[model samples]
Every structure is written in structure tokens, then in C-alpha cells.
Target chain A: MLLCGLTLLHALVSGSVPIPFATVLQLLGGQAADPAAGQLQTIILQLRLPRALAAMVTGGLLAMAGAYMQVLLRNPLADPYVLGVSGGAAIGALLALMLGLGSSLVSGGALFGALASMLLVFGLSHRHNNWYSEQLLLTGIVVATGWGALISFILAISPDQQLRGMLFWLMGDMSHSDTPTLEAMLLLVCVIISLPLATRLNLYAQGPMRAASLGVAVQPLQWTIFVIASIMTATAVQLAGAIGFIGLVIPHIMRRVVGADHRILIPASALGGAILLLLADTLARTVFTPMQLPTGVLTAMLGVPLFLYLLNKGRRT
Target chain B: MTVLSCQQLQLNVPGKTLVSGLDWDIEAGQFWLVIGRNGSGKTTLLQTLAGLRPAAGGEISLHSQPLQQYRRRQIAQRMAILFQHQESGFPITVQESALAGRHPHRGLWDWSDQDQHETVFSALQTMDLASVMQLPVDQLSGGERRRLELATLLIQDPELYLLDEPTNHLDLHHQISTLEHFSGLAAAPQHCVVMASHELNLGLRYCSHVLLLYGNGAWEAGRIDEVIDPERLERLYQHPMTVQPGSHGNIYLPA
Candidate 1:
């Protein structure tokens, strides 16, 4: 992890305006950047630093949320996308853009949409006495279809010039990040607020009946964890325009590597998710050199191969 | 004093009624062995009492509080259940799974050390299961999981213990050991243990009282001598079952 961080620092320092290690060190140590350090400090400290941090945090949050989703739904194949969280978030961000909200409403809007989807799914899935997994699956399909219709409606009525920006946003980008929301995302500290501590979440994974018998407040506890997961997933979607599989791919990879103790897996996954996304973003940004590709497309490109390999390995295990 | 009282309790499913319009009261510290054949209402009665399923009509009261008034967690703290059947394989360590019984006793913020650890530890040690503490639950041989679950139940430490076919999968040695262990639970004045089983001879030997569930929802709850009848069994279950004397002066079946 330290090596990865150091490598990233080195990469950031070597951007269009190159900064010396000594100047990077001085700036990190709380001293002002030397005039001799010039535009390099400006690029590294202001632009590259926030971008890198944002990628890492977003990736980490998505992965943890995805891991929680698979466990909560009790389906090995379940991911955030299957529950309509991703689709709702995408539709919300799309709508916000069409309204000329200009990115400020993106994260919270996505989070609100995710929560609405969750409530809808929960209400629909509840049966006479207990919840059935089949009902939940159907609800997800309904909500995702509804969100798709809304997105299409907004696009069909949008102006031609605005249409290009809307399409680009939907394709996903990290460039929408500003100084404030990124700072707010940092304050969210998903690990502290999420899963509502490791022990309860760990007990919950054993299935609802056992958990309830053991005295877990199953209904309230589940809702709390779900809300935290929704917030984290929404924040990630807003920052990176609904990037795919950071949640799904990273947790699966970590589960194969680390054991399933959520106490250990949660922290390990957060770090793993952050590091993997940072490297993926770095590769996306640098691979085409001067030409840029959307970080979301690159993530999917990287995720699919890794995901398939993990799937094959999972079958063997 | 009656610790559990039922007033006009009726358990009914969609098509037919299992047990209906029955009124009974069981005093504190009185153990019951409710015996019935397959398709009889023994399992249904127990599930209804445990609040897992709703009673079609009638009311049950525990310690003067209506059963419906107790939330799931409150009920969990007061009663524990051991299933007659369990899933064979689960991917977790015995210790990790056993600790789950402490689920109701803990607050969200912190896990109390003295209570949680002491409760789980004593439960494990009491069942002679400390040796297999770290073993994977799935890796344990067949009868071992039942013992582990027993430890979990003990950790729950509810005043009322409910068992459904508790001895179903055990070998002869384990069956006797389990029955004997249950017979020697906490001697508090209000503690009660209730189970349903086909092991009539064992039920006769250990249980303080018996509840016989028969055809057409015909029922009797009283002393074993009053309820166990050869002719009644022959007519109801349609099997020529017999009971004989055993070495401990308790009843046992030779055939």
C-alpha cells in the first residue's frame, strides 16, 4: 500500500509541469511551495491531488457498498446495479443536468433516488409474514425500467447543444468534481457511518432468522446499513457518473484474498477498492497519453477481464 | 403458580384446523413432553407458542403479558428454541456461530465483555464443546452441529426452553446424554422445558407432564400415566406401539 502511494506521488509529481520531490515534501510538511518549484506545485497540489484522492475514495465506497449488497440480498451474484441503485442514481444525475442544476445537485440527488428505490423494493418484497427474494428481484426490474423511461423522457425533450453535455455526463466523467463536494465526500467517512460497525453487520450476514433469534433488531439494523450503502454508492455515482463494478469487482477480489470476517474484510476491501481504482484511473489517464477517455469506460474495460477471472476462480474454489 | 396460560388457543392453517379452542394452564417449573405422530399439531402448537407463526384464533399469555405484546427481541430474551432439524452445512467457525446467541443482549454501540464472553464461554464449556471451539462448523461430523446449537441456546439463557424433535439425529448414546442433560437444567422455581417427540418411553421417564395430540384435534394435557394408553395409540396412529420397563424403572420399547 505504501509502495502504491509512493508510486502515485511520483506519477503526480511528473505531470505536465514537473515538480521536484523536495518541493512535494515541503508542501506536504505544511510549508509554502517555493517560487523555484513554479507551475509544477500549482498543477500537483491543486489539480492532480484532488483528482487522485477523489478516485480512491469513490472506488473504496463503491466496493464496500457492493459487498454489503451481495451479503444483504444473500445472493452471491447480486450487485448494486441489480437493486436499481445504480440506475436510479444515473437517472437522477441525468435529470439534474437537464434542469441546468450544473452538477451541484448530483451526489445528493443520486442518493435520494437510491433511497427511493430501496424503499420501493422493500415495500414490494415484503410478503404476508416474511420477505421473499423473488419479490425483491422483480421490484428491482420495475424500478430500473421506470428510471430508464425517465432518463429517455428528459433526453428526448432536451435541446441539441445541451444534448451533447448530457450524453457525455451519462457516459461518466471525474471532471465534474469541485472543491466543496469532494471535501464533503471526504467528511462522509463511509467506513465509520456505514454498516453501523462491523459486529452487527457480521451477525446479520448469518441470515435474518438466526440474527433475530440472537436479538438483532433485524428490521431497523438492515435499513440503517442499506441507507449508508446507498449514500456511499450515490456519492460514487455522482463523482464518476455511475462507474460500473468498482463495488462488485473489488469486493469479490478481496473476498477471495481475505477471509469473510466483515471486521477485517470491510477495512481491507475499502483500501483494496481505493488502490485498485487509483491505479485504474492512472492507467486510463496516462495510457492514451495526450488523448483522454472517460474514466468510467476504462473502469468497465479493466473490470470485465478481472471479473471474469474472479468468476472462474470462484467456481474452482 | 401458572407461568404459562393458554385461553381458547386454536392453531389453524388454510384448509383445516390442527388444534382448536383449547384452554390450559401450566404451572412454573413443570416440564412437558408433547407427543404426537406425523401430521399431528405438535409442531404447529410449539411454533404458535414461540410466536414464529400466528395462532388462527385464541390467546396465549406468558407471565401475565400477552404473547402478542412481546416484540421479537423481548421474546428472544425470555425464551430460546432448539430446532428438531438443522441445515447440515454452514461456512463459519463454531465459536463465531455460537456467539450469535448473545445477539439480543448487546447494544449497538458496544459489546459487553463480562456478560457476552461469560455467557458464550459457559455455554460452550457446559456442553463439553470447548475442544472443538475453533473448528469450522461444516467440518464438524454429523451430530456435532446439534451440540453447537445447544451451546447457542444455553448462551441465550431464556427462562423457557422449547425443543422440537431435539433428539432426532442423535445416536443412542447422544440421545440419552441429551435427554439427561435437559432433565438437569437450572433448578430455579420458574424454569420450564417443553419438547415434542416420538420417543414415548424417554418422554415417560423424564418429562414431568405430557400433552397428547390425537386425531380430529382430540387432545389431553396431564400426567403421563393418565394420557398414555395402548388402545388410544393403536386407534389414532394406526401402529401397534407398546411400552416396556427399563433398567432405571423408566419405560423403554423393546420392539
Candidate 2:
């Protein structure tokens, strides 16, 4: 959390209207900067501040969600978007874009579609409390493909004007969010996913038979966990477009330290996720001086090498 | 004292009839061993009796109430089962696996309370898994995992125990202890323990009722000596056989 906070602060101060770290700190402390540098300080304090904060929340939410997914499924490859929600959300946003719904409406459309796909999966997965975790897993892939096709169709027909913003947002950017939106997204993430995921998710890692024989209503619990996970993924995808790998990689590392015990692993994973994405976002902005890079690209660039190393280590083990 | 009665039970899986009309009264304080050749429905019958798989042909009643009316959890509170072998999703601690038995007692997403934890601890101790409670299930040797499974069932505190091959891979000491444990349950006049066993000698030595399934699906269920008669035993295994009786009504299975 501290790392994330620091990175956000730095992102604010390092923008075009460069505010010195001291002035940024002073301005954040509720005092005005020197009269000559007021425009520079205000630009950093007002404009870039919300954008940076949005990046932190978006990155944190994605990474935390990814960690939860990997641990819950016991599938190292799992991410927040492993199910169809991301693709479904994308399709909704794509439709909004083609229809000229604007960015504001597109966000809501994506979230709504993501949740709807999740509900469809949940409804289909439950045979009245009979667990179809495997079934749900397979269905997620199929539905994601179904939505991806629709999204592609919309994108092909879309004009260049709408396509430009859509493409940039899809790659994940912080500039899209202002202060109020970022705060609302943060509140939503906290309130919706605040419960102990580690404790509840242990059921899946324990296997269906063992969980059921031990008295867990496997189907209902399995659907509920994944639904919650998908919702978080959908929220993040809606808030900042699709950011990858933080969800896939972070929880796996947390598992190495915590030994797959959800009670200790879940919260630790959330902190790790928040910090890692915050660092990635900061690097994205800093790596290119004038040409701004999407944080998603930076994350992928960083993740590929790290994931390769972990994969080799995992194979050896 | 508690009794488990299965009346005209039929367990069917789609096109196949695993168990066709299994009827028996598993009275309280009796140790029953179900013996069958592979694919002869030993595990299926056990699963049905334990209410893990719903029977298609008949209804099961617990303590005179129809079993279907009661939820799986309500039934689990009164009966516990130990499957032959159950592997978890990954490496789970022996204590965590054992405490899973307290699932029926759990209200919603919560760990075992103080009283429940103590009971589980005692169960672990009884199964000689106290020292390795924190060890992951995948780390334990096969025999140790088997004992850990027994401890899981022990925590249920049920009136009856339904087990499928309770002693699959155990050292002589643990095996004898397991048999002795059931023997004691048989004599206690309160608990009813039913298990599937391939050990004929152990079955004759400990169990009060024996249900035998022949290679071609023929079955004979009754007293030990009655089912263990040389003539019937030879026909079932399709070989020459002899049963040498011990002083205390024990039947020995000699090679």
C-alpha cells in the first residue's frame, strides 16, 4: 500500500507541468505553491493526481483479483479474466463505442455486460447446489469466445474517431478517470470484495470430493467464489480496460510464501498485488519521457520475463 | 444405541445397475464387513448406504424418518463415511483435512469453534496422527494418509460409520489397531461401524455380520461362519478352499 501510495504521488509530480516533489508534497499538504509556479502545481495536483490515483486503484484491483483467481482455482494460469467476463465486458463496451454511447456510458455497459455474463455462468453452473466447477470452467472459455467474436464485429465496423479512444482504453490508461470516478471505483472494489477470500476459497483448492464429503455445498460455493472473482475482474476491466498478468502472477508468488493457506495468503496477496501494479504503472509513465506508454504494455513486458522464470522453476519442482 | 437399515435399496447410474435391490438391517453395536470382487458393487453399496449417491429404486430412512426428507447435511450429522482413498486439490495440512469433518456443523463460512476443534484434535490423536497434524496431506505416505482419513471421519461424532476399505495401506500395527477399534465398537452396544474388507480373517475375527459377493455377482450375506463355509467359499472364488476354525469362533484364511 505504501509503495502504491508513493508511486501515485510520484506519477502526479512527474507529469508535463512538472511540479517538484517538495511543491507536490506542500500542495498535497493544503498550501499553495509560489505564485509563478501555480499553473504547474495545479496541473500536477488537480489533473494528473486523479489520473495517477486511478491507475493505482485499477492496477491494485486487477492484481488482487488475479491473485484470488490463481489461488481459488489452484490453476497457476488463472487470471481475473480467466472466465468470460472480460471478453463479455469488452463486447458491451465495443457496442457502446459503435453506437456512440461515449466513454461514460461505455464504462457502465462493460460492467453490466461483465456481470451479466457472470450471472449466466453462475446460473448454468448450479444444478441446484450440485457443483459443476469443471463445467463452469469450460463454459467460461466458450462464452468468452462468443463475446470476442461480437466485439471484433463491432470493432471492424467502427469509425476511426471512436476506434482511437476504444483502442487506447482497451490497452488500459489512467487519463480516462477523473477524481470522482476513481474514488467510486475504489469504494466499489473495497466494499464488494472486502470479505475473507482465503478462507472461503480454500474449499476449491481442497478439491470437490473432499470439500463435499466434508460438508461444503461444492456447487454453490464454487459458483459464488468465481462469481465474486469475475465481478472484481469486470469492475477493473470497466474502470481501466483490460490489464493482464498481475492477477495471474502475484497470487502464485504469494502462494510460494504462504503454502496455499488462504487465511494468510489472501490479504498478503492483495498487498503484493497493489504494490506490484503501482510499481508497473509508475515505470510505464517514467520509461518514456514524452511519448506516454500504456501501463498494460509495461506490465506485459515485465511479466513475460518473470513468468518465464517462475514457469521454469515450477516445472523443475 | 443407533441402527442403520437399508431396505430394498437400488443404486443405478444411468444405464448400469450398480446395486440392484440391496436389503439389510445394520443393527446397533454390530460390525459389518461388505466383501466383493472388483466391479461387484462393494463401493456402490457403501456409497448408497452412506447417502453420498441417491438411490434410484428405494427410499432410505434414518431413525424411522425417510432419508430423502432430510438434507445431506442433516444425514451427515448422524452418519460418517471414509472413502477408500481421497486426494485433495493440492497439499492440504492433515489438521485442515481432518477438521473438514466438522463441515456439517459449520453454519456458513467459519472455522471449527473451540469445542469442535478439541473434538477434532482428539480424533487425530485417536488415529495416531497427532504428531503429523500440520503436515500436508500430499506429503504423508500412503498409509499415513489412510489414517488421516480415518481421523476425519472420527470427528463427525456420528452414531454410525460407513467406510470403504478402511484399511487399504497400513502397517501391521495400525491395521490391527484399526480392527481392534472396530471390534470395540461392535461390543460397545452404541456405535454401528460398517466397512468393506478383503481381509477374510479380520472380517471373521471382528465383524458380527458378513456380506459376501462372488466373482460373477452372486452374493451371500449373513453370519461369519455361515458365509465362510468351505463349500460356499470354494464356489465363490472358483477354487479349492478350507476354513480352519479358531477356539473363539474365528475362521482363518490359510493359503
Q: Write the per-residue lDDT of candidate 2 for residues B73-136, one digit (tens) a residue.
A: 7777888878876745756688877776776776655743565778888988988989988776
Task: Give the whole-model CA lDDT for all candidates, comma-separated.
Answer: 0.72, 0.71
**Predicted complex 1: CAPRI docking category:** acceptable
Q: Which lDDT tens digits does candidate 1 get at residues A22-97? A: 7787776657655755555666667777777777777788788887776677555556767777778777777777
lDDT of 1: 0.72
DockQ scores of all models, one per candidate: 0.37, 0.40
Pick by DockQ: which candidate is best?
2
Colliding residue pairs in candidate 1: A214-B104, A215-B104
- The worst-scoring run of ten residues by lDDT in candidate 1 chain A lies at A178-187
Q: Residue B203 CA error for candidate 2 (Å)? A: 2.6
- List per-candidate RMSD values in Å: 4.1, 4.1
